[model samples]
Target: MNDKENDSLPVSALQHFIFCPRQCTLIHIEQEWSENVLTARGRLEHDRADSGYREFRRGKRQISGLYIQSEKLKIHGRIDVLELEEINPKGQSNLPSFHLKGTWRVYPVEFKHGQPKENDCDRVQLCAQVLCIEEMLGVEIKQASLFYRRIRRREDVLINQELKDLTRNAIKNLHALFQNRTTPPPINDKRCRACSLKDICMPKRMSVKSVKYRQSLFQPQEPL
Candidate 1:
């Protein structure tokens, strides 16, 4: 498919891709989903952030449920919260916004139900938001934030070269997977235990069966 078609990819797929490719395919490709405690809590968290409101505090403007897109990245999604801060314009003009004036820096903030994970999934997701904002606003975003409900604090993320590269690569992979319409095989790992699709995926059973099949292929036949 052409880049234009791939541009319709969802930004959330990046997080799913990072979490587990199999899970990504199951949901996006197979259209399968099941809600568990964790997912329910996460939905609640997003609902609160997706209320669609704007507030001003401490010289900063906070907007919730901001829809953003990046045709360059071929991804589109709504940001949970976007914080804008006025800054000195470095001899460059900015596009006019109904809510923003002068030179303002954009900072995307994502809300989560739990504390940070061991991987960069959350960070990459936030970075994808930043990329969208940059593309839409024609501004450079150096950082963003992720708010964890359990911790009740925002973890700042730097939009460095490494993160940008990772986010781009993830978008590429997501497009490829979606275009091919292939659902990857299940991987029975620790993350699967928490996955809501565990029952439907049957990763453990499938893994065992695959192992037995491989072993059977290698086994020698006796006199029949």
Candidate 2:
């Protein structure tokens, strides 16, 4: 076992951290959660992956709900789907694969309840999965996909250096946050409306109180 495996956090926490650090802290640290319509819909969308099935077709192998972890990244989670395509070894005689007959390339797919977001949270989450698989199998994956149930489409994502760097940074930040064991102050922005933990977090009230505290610091001290 790798040294960091014992300290690993969940891969899903990367998405939560990227979306909002405070939200991530509330759930992963404070152990608080609430179910909203959006979250419930997402759970339903992932029902298919909960079965943990494997299938082979058209020279490709597919596995759903495969558990994966990366000691290097210090994260662990279950992948929604993993597709493997067979390829000739060619000049590369030392490629890692399933070890039955042929060399294979990995392609991970993450399922989402909604369409593509304007942020890289989903992409980072998918990339973390790829990193886990690469470490586990010793194969390099250069691309992955996201399946959006709402749009009914699969969007291809390049596992480029930028995305990998972003994913690693997020993982590092997550570990730091976990070590600190502190929930950050909330911004109470538009994103809060759709967040399931809004009521529990009370971002509006918290932000207002924070502002008043700062204002009081600058208030006149005539009576003093």
Candidate 3:
């Protein structure tokens, strides 16, 4: 059920699972990575804040490059941004009074250099973060947001029961893929253009071949 040297999985596992399990295992588990220009740009952007805390802004608190851990979920990862519900409106760093309010929030904001995606990969990744927070805080998180730098907008995501189910399934699937060590076939399209691992992923060639194979099987054996 677990690897002997198993480290806790990253919260981004959902993102990888949605993209391609092979890509996720390759990037995270094996720690193998290559830098394309897009990747490089992303790294440079993160370096701007992933190191330490910044001064509080606009009576609200902000933190960048946070490393969070959840014992229950057995997940760990870096959060790009965390909007701590400012305990003090007057600039003091007091934690929220759970005794009075009964609930508090740790709003996660993932920073992406690109625009919003057509699919739920990013949504799942962001949701994964919320799940980790829930496991850590022992509270039901209702929602979170992802901020796209290119578009300069915050897209809110609801943490409904449906997303929770999908996230759990993704984690199970991810562990299974690692054990099997099989890279799924590629799914070609415009998405390939944005994926830095496209060359290693072979999504386009694999998907084209898949379609061809299916067609041949249905062509009636060319009259034998």
Candidate 4:
């Protein structure tokens, strides 16, 4: 893919990848969505997070939320939360948010369900957000964070080169998924038990098939 296609990635892609590649492809590529209790609860949480815009000051740090987008980044999405340095206090009202002073300073926060996982999925999403911010503000963001609803605490994240690579790779994967237009077979694991797509993915059935295939592979080919 050309640079144009690579950069055409969406910030939400990172989240979908984290949740499940198949689910991500289904939602983004197929434009399909069905809400279960888990999705409903997540939507509610985000709804509460998006309801208002608040910027407060505490010891020289300014906290703001619900920042919509602008001409920068060229991608449309809302950031969960951002911490900006205190500058240009009551300054220019006409200045675009991306041009606001402390433009080089930013902290992106993403809210998630359950606790942290043993994967880089969430970090990848946060890194994508940082990329958006960097492109929009014409600055570099080196770090971000995620807040799990279940944990009710923040885990610091770094948008280092590794994460940047993951973000780029993830975008490529998402593009390939869209091009293929295929839903992946279910991944039967403990994680599947909590996934809302259990009914649709039929992970248990897929797992059984996998087991049977492996068994057959191991079975002796004596008659050959």
Clashing residue pairs found in predicted model 2: none
Number of the candidate with higher TM-score, 1 or 2 = 2
Best by TM-score: 2
lDDT of 3 at 151: 89
| Candidate 4 per-residue C-alpha lDDT over 78-124 given as tens digits, one digit per residue, 9 for 90 to 100 | 67877765445665432256445432356778888768988777887
Question: What tens digits encode model 3's per-residue C-alpha lDDT throughout 1-224?
Answer: 46532746777765867876657866876676777888798788888568767556654567778777666556678888877664434443234332323223568888887888887888888877787766665556687888888888989988899987887777777767766775555667676777778776677666857857866786776555
Who wins the lDDT comparison? 2
In order, the Cα lDDT scores of the candidates are 0.85, 0.87, 0.71, 0.68
Q: 1-224, model 2: which lDDT tens digit per residue?
A: 56576698999888999999999999988999999999999998798886788898876888999889987777899999998776754435333445545567778999999999998899999999999998988878999999999999999999999999989988998999999996788968988989999999999877967867866889886785
Give me the displacement of residue 162 in model 4, in angstroms: 1.0
C-alpha lDDT (0 to 100) for residue 156 of candidate 4: 91
For model 1, how does the per-residue alpha-carbon lDDT over 65-131 read when each residue is reduced to its tens digit? 9888888878989999988876754423364764445677778899998999999889988998999
Q: Which regions of candidate 3 fall more than 4 Å away from where they truly are?
A: 1-7, 29-31, 57-59, 87-104, 204-224
Q: Order of candidates by TM-score, top first?
A: 2, 1, 3, 4
- Summed backbone clashes in each candidate are 1, 0, 0, 0
